[model samples]
Target: MADWISRDDRLPVPVTAYGPLHLLARHVHRLSDTGQAHEAITAADAYLVIARIVRDEKSVRFLIQGKMYALLALGRVNEAYPLAIALLHSQRAAGSVLGEAKALCDLARIHLLGGHYVDCMRNLARAGVLLGTAPAETDRHRSALCSFATAATAAELYEAAAGAYEQLRHSTSSFDLVHAVTLLYWGLRLAHVGRSEEARSRLRRSAEITRAWLETDPDPTITAMHALALAKLGETTVAEKLARSVIMELRAGGSHQYARMAHLALGISLRAHGFPQEARREFIAARDLTEEGSRPDERPIIRFELALTALDLDSGQASRDLFETVEGQVRELWRLRLQRLAMLRQARQREETEAARARAEREILRDPLTGLGNRRRFDLLIGAVSPAREAPLTLLLIDLDHFKAVNDIHSHSVGDLALREVAAILRAHCRQGDEAVRYAGDEFVIFLGGDAEAGSEVGERIRMAVAEADILTDLHMTVSVGVATWSSGMTGEQLFQAADSRLYAAKWSGRNTTAA
Candidate 1:
């Protein structure tokens, strides 16, 4: 097992039965960082095998992350995409907020690779929300911040990318390798924003840090980054020579991934020194190499550089052709962006439509005057009650005594108030798994959970509560209730009819009474 991972990207690999698997996972990451993508994938697969045998879900996610990074580095974005999503879901299932945030960042990187800037920004925003409370000093937070910066840069949000890098630079308050890498991204952000002097300063610092590290371990990716820093600083002669040397070494070692970066570095240097023709050739070579193995988004960037170089070339036809090609690609990218926006708008519309429909349904089922379930709601509740599946059902049918006289002697408004008061009393008597409805003008129904005895008790309590209420005191309003319990063979309609007959008995036997 490697003692540590680059001293900058180290993670704790616990000494346990799965220690070998962890070691393998770290090796996979190291291989990917060194541009040995194929070897990294193979190592990741071996790690996955051991993790599966141990049934370690966390280990599995780590392996998936490593393999996915390797695949992405190899420009196998379609293959990496599913793995990115899987990592997100797995972390969510594990209920690790930090892990889920990291997974979101990984998914954002995949979106960046495909030039899906809108989607990339959305994922980065979500990750930021998740990491809002995470400690800044942790490796997970630093990793997520790095991803945010990279994605923001891809989306052309240079200010936001620079802000993230600034946070990363201040996280440890030390001049370490992590800070060095952050400086490089910070420099890239500055370059995009046209602050060339500031960009050169940051790049130089990052290059110096990496140069010191390279003396101990000759990492080609680090070497390429140093060349890029030199190129960006406008050290044209030395930058061009170093870039060429790095490209030759990487290509000879079959590390075309870093070779592409070296080519870009050389192009940048040549362009800065007024060698447009040489710059154009280097840019074209980089673009071709990117098409072979780099991320889909990288080729267009190289083409953009190529177009810029072509603007100063002697051949007008070549210049127009290059400009046209870049314009067409940009137009297609914009079209895709618009299509995604339209789909999102349509999805939001569908959700709003569904919500409006649900609100309308609720309004229809509710009584406007009493805020209680209406007749339609009563019917639906009764239809759901079955003797075969539940305990004996109880129905309480209630009516206001001399309710018409109250409406006639008093105002209709007073009668409405009295009805609302009765509904309140019925609701107070309702228990869990019970339904209360305003069945008609003055009649109410409640489906109770138990036998007729329980129904009669609730019905009596509602009767007394209504008789004593101060509402429309002069009208002396009181409610009579009828209680009916269903037998195993009785239907909902038969039970309702029985309750109605009992209601009639209560009216005849004295008002303000319960008849069971």
Candidate 2:
């Protein structure tokens, strides 16, 4: 397990002075740093008790922020809502624009997890306005934007959500556990929005990237996110182990909020695996953490899910009441969802039409004969290739061996057939994100996006494929491939020249070979 998501990219959050809020934060950080969820929650609760008795608005807000942060870190969606809603009102009363926006965003998060799309968007819109009106750029703007993105995902506004998350996942502070937990929600929302595979990819990537930090110390939220992703992707054994491990870690840590969320995640995974009884027990454990007045909306959330599970198990009165209470609301929201989706789809029609037209225009850069992108297309690609932290792009210059001789003996028609066949082979080998181009007659260039290490493997695969296939029966063909990876200082011309030099080296060494 790699310990770094890159040394500089994901360092540990710096420890702060241990005020009650800061102390709670330090313990709260343990959810990711040490998996001490139980302790964190207990500490927060103790703090809240003192703050409520003292009842100073400033102190109350401070304590509430600390506790709310703990709850959110633990992924306690239901438990967090009532406090979040109250915080929103309190912040508005304080006339702290940034705090109010942050509060609105937090409330949106609560609604989002509850599947309250309308409420989520409503809060997001109001938050966005407050965020915009803020005199200067602040963390509240960023937080509000994240909530907007989450709402977009919950609303199944995929295009917007996709774009929003693409920016957010890159922009958020990776070292912060709260930000890391948001990644879980980002992934869940992605899955709910019908981008399941995308969600799996993202979550697993998060796991792989965070494995280093997690290996050094256990983090319930990251571990849980990883487990959930793996389970969704059908890696049941490993995922189950990871998910079950969270309970032990949470209990050991003794953080109420983190324990609640961990159980909730485990319960969802269990439900997916057809363990309704096990799932119910996990959900109940999560719900038991709630105080009567903490989240009145909590029952409907759990009950709705309980009713579904009860259908397969022995559902009780609570499940029936929840279903009866929430069923109409769920239906109405779903109805609104369909309407929203229809309008979104309609709005996209013109956008799609414009895209199609642009695509047609771009096709002018495609080679008419082989259907691979032509030199013109390659030029555009080269121009777009800023030497940022993109994948190390490999340029493979593939030239047909003894091509002039083939035309001399077999006729240009046969030569054309060979070129077309080679193009077809390139097309077959490349996927959606890979780029293949006809650089010139008898010469092709392929840009293996981020697959630089696979240069030899890809070349070998293509060479063997060409060797095995007969474009014109009994007329065997081979290609000499030259590969060069782009370096930070290299220009497009330099990259092309390096690959070209390798091509010549291949030609000189052997008629049918690859040189890198």
Candidate 3:
């Protein structure tokens, strides 16, 4: 070993220093994987100094970020946050978009592990947008990072991450090992969201990849993930065996995180296999190890799991004590959320109140019964516009073809429902910037934001939706629509008049079509 080390001077310095960091990261990851978090954190600190001295800033940043992730994984979130935030800020300042995205992704993962779902979502969204702007060369790393972040948040968000990973997978145009791991992450996320069959399929593919790799170079993390996949697939015996192997490897190598995760997997497998006593012991050990190095918030989940296990063990007092602690923490979290909600509600109310006041002021210029812009408001708007600023605008006038018959055939209740249904159809079909109003008892008007062709399309769509509405299942209902565009010298009133005349022509021609 000494002779080989001396002979490999070219491979020694950078490889040796970085090799330990890699090993430490893998160890921390395994400890996290196995639920031996106490041991993982103790081993993780040794990599910090060497990681800082790496010549490549990007690689070093990722190394430190991975350490922070491990810290969080071990439930050491408070310890992770300051360093994570500083690294993220530094990456952002350096204009390393991909690095910044990765940092944010890590921070989000910490929040997620701590069960801060909302914060996790916010950070994931930010990271996603930044990662979108990242160059293609970094796509694989970003995709994996984002997938992890998304999976940690909520199962529903995993689809987005999966889509990103798919894009990366296709762009890379290779059957990379990381792609298989990503598929496994996506599978677990799918299971969380109740897509069991699809999850199983993906997990099987992931297992195949890991198995192939393990044939040549066995990695404990890969084995651990395979165990999780097997467990998810309901292969309890196989999962347990794999988990045991992973644990042995971790113990042999003094790898904390893998051991912790392996313990967690073993506990799950035991519980599934009806070994309650053994399962409880493993769960307790896993929980204790996780809590040993984790943040206060992170500890709650571990505590919660432990409490549940205690309940299952019929230890009433222990369970009750754990519940009380959980309750207090939950209440604090609720209070903070409520405060934020209250502040948002107050701000929204203020804005709405101001909007209501403005609407009230404007109401004076609208027709009372029809809620349409009164002639005065139209006159004011048209008069205020200079000829130089005038652009093409279309107006549409609509009329219920047999509204009087509707009121006569149906009671006023049905008649009102019919009118409201038509109004809703109009509202739904209209463009966002367009305006629709009840012009009178049987007439409606629309102010279009664009040219005659666009207005004609809007008029047609509204007519179709109204015709299709099931408001009067017994009666066949339809409307006459007319569209007219303002020419170079036309006034707004002239436009309305032309549209109205065309509407009458439409009623005369067919009583159920648009006239353009």
Candidate 4:
């Protein structure tokens, strides 16, 4: 066993079996960090054996989760899923909310890498809820770290994540520096979404905090992230200098992943600042490093960057070849991603269908008697069709005159019948492109897609049709209509306001009228 451990380059085991299991996990982590994934897997298997023999549940669970994490990190997520599920169940059964949350977050990260955004969001939301209820300080820190990881994968969640990190930054003791680096990650994402000023402020604080921590003990990842933020801020010269220093350290230490990413950043920054030749060299170096490290997934990004550089260099054939290669890889990736998405969507549809079948779902704004849209739906329809300047649209507001007399003279059921008949008349006469909505108890709104005159013609046609329809023998309903057309300077709200004002004017002038 000692010889096996020595051959594996793992730490010497103490007399206690659990000690060896712990050391083996650490050894596997180190191997993985250095890009020796095959060796890491071998060591991880050995650790599992020791963990089983030790019969310590905590050590065994920790080793198993670590092994699964390493597997996911190496892009073997299919193999990691069963292990992750088992870990999650075990943690939950033990009331280890923090552990369960962390496991969920890790699973989410794997899904994110595979482009399963919905699944990723589901797991992240669960983890966030559990983290909110976690009791201990250590658990809170762990949860915060997981939250940061999930947020980093999905850029849309950057603002919420930044707030979470800010809260955790003040409370956490362990991995304080790592937390600072995580904040920088969120800051970069915020910057990508056009929040440049906010991003710059957060990044500046993160760099200051990280630099202070690194003064005592250097972290290559923090240095690389800082360089990336500087690049985003357009400080290309300073960013390039920092990135080069990280690259040298990574190359010397045999950390190919960090070196590859750093070089890619340097290449992009150089290109942005008009150093095409140096940028090409850096991109090629990044590509070579990733290829040498045998990371196929990382290669596509580097190849895409190389193709872009070739396009700039005026090498059309070379650029085309690189683009074709990237296109093929992207198609394959998208195929797998779509297959996973279809599975998730099918599952969600089944759940929704079952739930929808269990009850008569009520539409909040529906006419209870006629099964037509009510006033609320009408307002929503009007709000939904607010026009852009590029497309001219028209609105028609119609109100039934003396509607109260129908309810007062006839039974409520007869009044309801008359209203339903008038709604049908409006619906039948409106063109296919026009939307008719019940605006109030006895009023309707129509949105049309034609010029002003056409809209007025359609309104008249609806009025004539309603006049011809016979619902109740003694009831006659005449609709007062107002037409409003959208112009380049109008917004949706303004259009509605203008149309509504005209509608009231028409009603006041005469009981049955159409005014533009």
Best by lDDT: 1
Ranking by lDDT: 1, 4, 2, 3
* Lowest lDDT block of 10, candidate 3: 294-303
Candidate 1: worst-modelled 10 consecutive residues by lDDT: 340-349
Q: Which pairs of residues collide in model 1?
A: none
Predicted candidate 2 versus true structure: per-residue lDDT over 354-441, tens digit per residue: 5567779778998988999998998988777665645678888899998999999999999999999999999888754688999889
Model 2 has a clash total of 8
**Residue 258 error, candidate 2, Å:** 35
List ranges where model 2 is wrong by over 4 Å. Answer: 1-342, 387-390, 408-411, 431-433, 449-453
lDDT of 1 by residue, 21-125 (tens): 666677788999888999999988887888889887767887888899899887799999999999999888766777888888789778877877667656766
Give me candidate 1's TM-score against the actual structure. 0.48
For candidate 1, give the lDDT: 0.76
Q: For each candidate, what is the lDDT?
A: 0.76, 0.68, 0.66, 0.70
Could you tell which candidate, 2 or 3, scores higher by lDDT?
2
Q: Which stretches of candidate 4 lie over 4 Å from their true place?
A: 1-55, 113-115, 139-144, 147-168, 172-206, 214-223, 244-246, 261-265, 292-516
Error of 1 at 219 (Å): 8.0
Give TM-scores for every candidate, taking all chains together and pairing residue i with residue i: 0.48, 0.37, 0.39, 0.48
In model 2, state the lDDT of residue 347.
Answer: 41
- Give the local distance difference test score of model 2: 0.68
Better of 1 and 3 by lDDT: 1
lDDT of candidate 3 over 118-201, digit per residue (tens): 666566666655555457655545454545444432323434544555665565634345556556655754554456898888
